[model samples]
Target chain A: MGIVSPGFSGRRRSGSELPPGQYLTRDFPVLSAGPTPHIRTEHWEFTVTTETGEATKWDWAALLALPADEITKDIHCVTRWSKLETNWKGVSLDTLLADVETSADYALVHSYGGYTTNVPMDDLLDGQAWIAYEYDGEPIDPEHGGPARLLVPHLYFWKSAKWVRGLVLSDNQDLGFWETAGYHEYGDPWKEQRYAGD
Target chain B: MTTDASYLDGNAAAGALSQVFAMDVTAAITQCNGCGQTGVFAESHVYVNAPGLVARCSGCDGVLLRVVTTPSDVYLDLRGLTYLRLPNP
Candidate 1:
């Protein structure tokens, strides 16, 4: 008969198995606005404005009524925990941008909790990004950022801002919260952009 | 030379609570002065010699605590009994 449990495995099994390295948790207070010129989505609307001036605005209910798709992927946090097989459902950013006609050179992704990330027009238009509304097959909990969030799976988790509300096509790229706080501007998980230098 | 009296709700160590979001250890023990009793604080944790701050007591809701760094551990006295942030294992 084959042995059930291996004695020489030398692996500690438990319900809570932490990922490699120490995980540090910070009590980050959510900020809703910044000194820079920006718009707040709580009172404002996400208007898909075009260079030709045709535009359509989406409110909370109208935004939720859009199509939803499920995705499973690994998420690498800037704090260094790479969670595998996370599932989320939301509208694709590519589909949203397709509805707009933009000649702007760049775009700024605006989010609640007073966060913003900049992307080149080409970069924004190329990725498999989504505005996630559900997590793990249910409505995302408030603590995990409810209402809506931006999921940029290609980059570190911090780039996936919580309570995300709008996207503004601009002619320039601006840095967001962690980006201004010594975090890498382009947080690519493949390159291990966990910090400014690493 | 210290008494081992404890509180019911860990009120003395009220300033040493740490939030256990994922796998963190929360509600560490602390010494209380009021009731002359101490108990396990459920909300506080301490950071030893971190940049800009010496120690933080999450039990007291992000209050700064006294720093007494030793070779083995960082000792923080909540009321009278010491709360130690042990070295990472």
Candidate 2:
């Protein structure tokens, strides 16, 4: 006699498919802490600033001009919902950071409406992350982080900042908004690292 | 105060808070102690990415409520808010 939500399929995956304390959801729930900031594509810009203050910027057209890749990945949120096989199209972070040379170890991501998050520089390089603008072959809705959002599927969804605008390379680690407020500095969903302690 | 990318407003916490609070907590008006600003809880910033659900003052980014749920107990801290005016049911 387990309580199930209205549309829950009652289907269970093998132990390896889902992480501990997580449930699979067919719907992609929209969760945001504040009002959705509507940014026009014409007014959008993405910047990458180095520790020394050197910054390189890409406008909306410039960003779209870059080579894009189609990615299908599983995303797990700390709130206990895991959505698998999500599709997205975007420019890889590797392509964005390629020309920029830096010895920094951390990346502080900034969003359009003043939101910020920090991630290890290594985690965003290689084929690990991207600045996604399209979902399921359509332009992403503003409510779901439109113009472009950081997509890092390896860690918890929170590590993937929404409405991303810039990335600041830092030599030392600094906690972002949630990190300073007691969320785990590194949100690894597989280990259930939801809070600072565990 | 710096904005958090991993957070949503108080309205987002209504679903989680409903487990403890019977009524709609988002519609409740709250006064912040730090800035003495009054606003609906639905507009306050909420960070659910952590172990607990934290609702912050939209005016000053102060923690207005913190709810932590463990296996045995649910702890709620509302020290940052001077008062919360709940609607009559």
The native-contact fractions of the candidates, in order shown, are 0.00, 0.04
Model 2 scores a C-alpha lDDT of 0.82
Candidate 2 per-residue lDDT over residues B53-73, each given as its tens digit? 878787877678877665555
In candidate 1 the C-alpha lDDT for residue B46 amounts to 36
Q: Give the per-prediction TM-score of chain B.
A: 0.23, 0.91
TM-score for the first chain in candidate 1 comes to: 0.70
- What's the C-alpha lDDT at position B9 in model 1? 25
Task: Kindly report the docking quality category of candidate 1.
Answer: incorrect
DockQ of each candidate's interface versus the true one? Answer: 0.02, 0.11
Interface RMSD of each: 17.3, 6.7
Q: Residue A4 error for model 1, in Å?
A: 36
Q: Which residue ranges in model 2 land beyond 4 Å of their true spot? A: A1-16, B1-89
